[model samples]
Target: DGVNYCTISLNQHIPQYCGSCWAHGATSALADRIKIARGAKGADVQLSVQHMLNCGNVGSCHGGTVDGPYQWIYKLGKRTGSGISYFTSQPYLACSSESRDGICKNADTSCKAENIARTCSTFGEPCVGLSEYPNATISDYGSIMGKNAMMKEIYNRGPISCGIDANPLLKYTTGVIRGWSLMQDHVVSVVGWGTDPEEGLYWIVRNSWGEYWGENGYVRVKSGALALERSCTWAVPDTYTAPEKNNEIHCYEGGENCKVSAKDESTAAAPATRKPELWKRDEVERRGFQWRGNSSTPSSHELLFTPSNGFPETFSWCDKDGKSYCTVSVNQHIPQYCGSCWAQGSMSALADRIKIARKAEGIDIQLSVQHLMNCGTAGTCQGGEPNAAYQWLKEISDKTGSGISYTTGQPYLACSKDSDAGFCKGVDFSCTAENVQRTCATFGKKCVGMAKYPNATVAKYGSIQGKDAMMKEIFNRGPIACNVDAVPILNYTGGIVTAKSKDTDHSISVVGWGTDDKLGFYWQVRNSWGEYWGEQGYFRVQSGALALEQDSCIWATPKDFTAPERVNLLHCYEDGSNCAAAVSATELVVCVIERPFAGSPACLRSPASGSSGMIGSMFQAGWGVCLERSVARTWESFKKPENHANNWEEAVSFWAVSFAHELAHFESPLHDRQHGRAMEMSQRAVLPGLARVLSKPWGSAVGSQNVVHRKWTLQGSGGNLLG
Candidate 1:
């Protein structure tokens, strides 16, 4: 049974599937599409086909030569599945015999009684549709290696006979689905091979099981051809003459109406259809950097999600490795390739999350990559509520939104699953808060005679009163939010104490007391170690008396709130007094803000210089001096390698910080009493970028003089950058 193995090898190489083989005929190509062919039982067996045949006794070969030469037809193969049968003729191949004079003689053997081999290949392909091929061509097909190997292999790769066409009628063309491999004595046609950098070669061949296989899903090829050549099968095609439209064709197993070519006997090389050119239609590049596969391979349960209402805000994390990287741009409804590709890089991925959180109820949040970075900073105040975001979120949300519906002020924060180990990448805020004492904890304020403001609290003095006596100097200056807790105060009373004071021990301490609205709001006042103070140390007066007597105040609400302003001042004395009657009056302001920085030294500043009016001077002078001092210290801090940053991104961050410290001084005349000696320049806009030329090696990192911020940003920075 002569079979066309060449046609089988023509169809097996693509990325999708593999072609397995059964009754051996030198298993060659890969099987792509799989389908049901025939056979009732499913088991494993081997089939043996006769490899040689005597064609009218031309002993050495065919071609009407000596004694009707004997020739090689198809080989045998072993396969797994049900039963077995031998295959007959298929039209995809053709054969021509060579005379002793080396002439390939074509016989009048076209299956359809015509001269051309149309059914062998689509058109413009090799000759086909015949039973006996010259032994030389058959033997030559075996020496080939891989897709890129020897010249013999190169000969098998032209005309791509294996790709799946759109035609539904060409089903069995792929072979595996046809169950033709099940035949015991059957050998079939050849297809193609696989040469992906990964898996090598599989096979593709045909059978007599109608057109059910449609070219795929039936056989298996020897994995790498290492030891299974004995299982190879082969075939030959009979050229069909009458052509039919592809749509009108049916599942015919043997419509072999084709013919062999006259040129088969030359043994000369076939002309290649292409030539190398400098210009190419495809691009090639090096791919060495992929240490791992380009994409991440997460665990099975890993899923990407767009948080409920907090899309991009709430990111789902499935760890492929131990590190915490965020896939913030996930889309919950569709797989990543649909209306959703990984949404990253652009502003939409992050900013959108923030806008979403703003609309949600419960908590106010800001969750951006930057937000994550902020919360993760070794330096953020967290609105003075240290270590509280998580707990605060817990408190705000109703259980319905507990897991995630709770919102945020900023949505695009780089987020990952909250691990039990804690977000290891962030700063330990709880620890930082507990250690606040290490950063600043010394409450020691001092006052004498009379303070400038009404809300003064002397560690030693209570609200003293009367003319030129020890009690008169007690309540003077306004309270100081200027220092850390306004502690360590100096009391100026040298009088006796009484019972109500509880011996907090001071010549003049307010100690503590009850307020009576109807009784003029009394203050339980205490006095010095001398006189017989009210029962061991104190006495009470109307609540309103404290305000009138010493300039005390009410606790103020937030600026936009409806509560009354605390410490609302009523000037004690003014400019209408006669010269002889003029007594000194002190002006004090109790502020609600804490000192901005812990160690920024305090200064007793006057109104700024060069300002035209008294009001302007008062507004700027005292503050300007303090800021000048702060700028110098910041410059010094940037000198060390550990602190000297080179990037503009980081430089801008520092600029904001430095500006903040300066604003602190501009607004409050006395505060943060700590680093005055470090002054170099008065403000960020004023500090020269890249310190003085001569001091580069020894001096601090000063800012650029020409880089003042924009008017808007400047306005917020204590309103200075503009003019």
Candidate 2:
């Protein structure tokens, strides 16, 4: 299943040598569990270890237990402030040389003004003030003593922090570490568990050491071998606060504030026709079944069917044959259970279709559900229409050339427990336009640029009615975004579900259809819930059941899918002396070159001859070249001469040779160590190539053109050449 889940990978490297495994293990596990609980909203949160190292009563550096960090986080509440901070906020600074095992530097111990000043200066941003920094409090924490219990907790929640004897692990570079040691010395977070064919079984444990330490800062330790299974702990975050519900405030159609109470019908009478509830059918229709979405209309493009010949025995884009035309199926749990399924379903379907149209090459394009959730004009966490989301995609694509961005560009942060209305507080959705503009200006760009195949217009999309129509569309095109009654399906773990219901509440993707011997026919559907909830983020629905075949189903075809071409352009300068001129010229060149090359290319001037220098380098470094100053000076000397033919010919020949040498450097930054023979050959080739071009005199005459050569003057130089 394509559920966008976040992983708890340790990004912070303990400075120099510090045995803060206790801090690292506890913080890592807590943060991972929080993100998982939030349905992996793509929020990168690294709980502060420096907070525990400096402030916690835990035995620092030498050794400590998982209980110390857990208790500290529980009491002080981990955050970026005096007591705690995010990894990016405070970062980790190894204890001072003067500070011994139990002793800590005064600066490391507390949030002093000098410490705050230093942090601000280092990061070039205002320190997360003592008051401004928010705390992540834990309601309760306990130890998972047994190995089975630890595995169960991790599977149910997320990672668990545990103690392990890490002396044998010091030299561990790779492979599953298998050794039994009850003398637990260090702590590490058990992120996940996996079994290797050769190595039997192992636990994916996260280490504090930098990425270069283990398997990218993680280790696969043998299961039940080390003391890791002996001790482990887990905690629950107190991030959930009940949403404020005001029954008196009646939100009318179009979300207008009518200011009238629900009981007062005399003011502005509630619409006689009940608006179709697009979310939480079981809850919305608690009293009686209410219509969801407009009455399903028969698809205009529906194929003429033969009653005698039913749908093909079984068909699925995703099957056992490994020949899947549909893009890799994905799942998206709107972080915090936000009721944006309408938007999620439409975006997921369209993005997947786009991928299939593009032949499922390279990077999988995950269109931003958050973009549709926050920026889209449909409904908010308070439910929305799937058609409205499709319409939003069309409108945004028209306005922004490229459709909405990928997930990383704009991540989903609107986390809410209530399916009725989502909470947008403490999210990217709260950023002001001015703040966004200022931040973008500071960073030198706004948004994640335009997408290559951004304009994904629904060529022809309509409600897919009946099982045959849905199956036909899936077999022909790709997956179809459809609504299903999920009230009973929430608790469903495996097997074909056959819940009888006409009320369609939740939106999901019908990727394919298949049949099982025991369960009969079924639809392999992908849900937005986390992978832990269903069969690895996918569930089989009983064919023709749950109002799936009767209700709304959208089939979209990606329009004009084409990959963007790559084009590299560089402006060659005579010498690297004109640094200011090169910088000014590059800014203009980027715009000019970007038109032809849809993707942004590096536009920089070559370094002056001889000296290897990076003169006109952009913030994002790219390849640069250095030309010989003598070559440029020689070309300049031939600008105005008594012998025009000789001088011009020599100038052109030298220019070509210099251009080839610099172009080679631009193309391949790594120098060819095959002596100067290759360079000599390239120089020799340039003259002949220019001679061949010059021989074709009429080649340039294809169009009516005037050959008016201007006298070359080196920029930033006072006098004319050869003066």
Candidate 3:
């Protein structure tokens, strides 16, 4: 009764801007009502406003009737049983049929199948439409006018969409709008009501603008202001597509693509959702986890196998083959206490799967929980969903062709939206490339963002429950992440935990199951609170203790990962200021030969002149490059007096560019002019600042020609550098 069933915030202006406030308002209200109808369990089901804009006869970016979308969805479900698609299937593109400007100019705003619900193998185009995507159907729709009816509808069901004045809200910021204009133009949803000490009674309203605007994406308006209480709309959500227990719906054909969208429990048989249960966080009870419930009848496969049916009496991925396939134990409380059990648990399970995928052969890879915390849609330090973490991982793999990085690449920094628990006090949680993964400078070099880094990817992932499903997944794959109560195990020393409470507030990975002589059956669970706590960062719980097996447990499959190798790896510039891309096939090995006198051609002399041709000689011996020290010294001597203070640093730059030019030959034909252009472009791509310095003419000190062609020889060392 005390649960907040409202879903996460939404913005109509992401990726691009759209003025579909009517559709956003209507769909959001209906989505909240659907969540309310489903008892707030499982991942929140967000309705797609884009879906409505494409098909809802009511709205566009320009505007439309607030009640029309509800009527349209209700009638669509009544007629065809397919009311609206989910936001996950058809994420917002902020385009509409009415507006042909901006992003909508080339967008497909039609009611085609792909336009309605599409999934892509990558982030870009060439997407296919699922013939049967999950949809939410509405039973009835109606409209009401006046304050009392609006309040009753919201309190009884959920939030209701309402209209409001346009001109006065243009400058509205953080307060209850109170004015005389009854002009109704913009539409918003009224979630609830509150009484301010100064403003008296006000309606808690949500806007289509992003969370950065007004009171966390909400603005309270004075009761009955601007005719906001004059007109309102509400819809009764009837049923939505949901997966059966221990199963998932494939969003695409062949059952090989991403899993279906999050499901709700409500249906024709179970019209009313489960009642809301309440739990709080405290010293003796630290429950911050959630179980995303499932619907539909269990499959025959689910009924065939129970936990003890043909299953081993005891099995553990940790001790399998006398080797621990799991990654090292982690501590979320270090640097500061972070409630990132969700990230730690899921990522650990995924890493263990990766290790198992490799047959526990090579290094036990540890995934970066910090990378997930930095870029994942899953909740943060306060609490979050482990299932959502896997879902987000798969989504990123689809978007960027990669998933989370290793812990060695992006170490843990327990940071999030609210909590600043330790070393993460001033961290940024933006999901940019640099924010996702970046390195700090060393040896006085400026920090450079890594354009390409190694990463692990997800092949498939989904939620599972019940002891049999958990055991089967663990026995087959490796380990799984699940929710726990955490209260009873706070001071646990050893032995099996038999706590009765199932109020899950923490997340931990279940590695395997075991049998105890006196304790009966128990789960071998791994915790993220460092190695010093409770059985060396692990504990055993009686099979179903704290709803360990019943709550949402997550499993992810590792597709492939970049092996950490040094072949063709990026090399640093001579001064360590920037990186020079490895553009050669084989590793470039250079040998430096210092000449005794300047302008002597010491490297080019023949045996006939009483000296062997060192350049010709080294080329015969198969060196990648021959660096003449006299030419380096000549460039140093030719430096301007103004550059004398940084002469040593300039010399380092000169040598780096010289090597860069010779390496450029491997990428192109052995032509001096083409190699020169390739070297110039490579310098600009790798280091723009240094490219500018090398582009300048040396003021007749080195005789007017560019230093690249004047001082540096452009020969391929033995012509083997290309290989």
Q: Give the TM-score of each candidate.
A: 0.14, 0.39, 0.42
Return the candidate ranking by lDDT, descending: 3, 2, 1
- Count the clashes in each prediction: 148, 12, 3
The top-ranked prediction according to TM-score is 3
lDDT of 3 by residue, 522-572 (tens): 999988754334554578999779878767677777876754231322222
Better of 1 and 3 by TM-score: 3
Off by over 4 Å in 1: 1-186, 195-201, 214-228, 231-723
lDDT of 1 by residue, 449-511 (tens): 111111111011111122111111111111100001000111211222111211111112232
User: How does each model score on lDDT?
Assistant: 0.21, 0.50, 0.60
lDDT of 3 at 423: 25
lDDT of 3 at 322: 49
**Model 2, global lDDT:** 0.50
Residue lDDT tens for model 2, 114-196 = 12211111111232222222235687889877768987898888888899987776656566989889788878888778989
* lDDT top scorer: 3
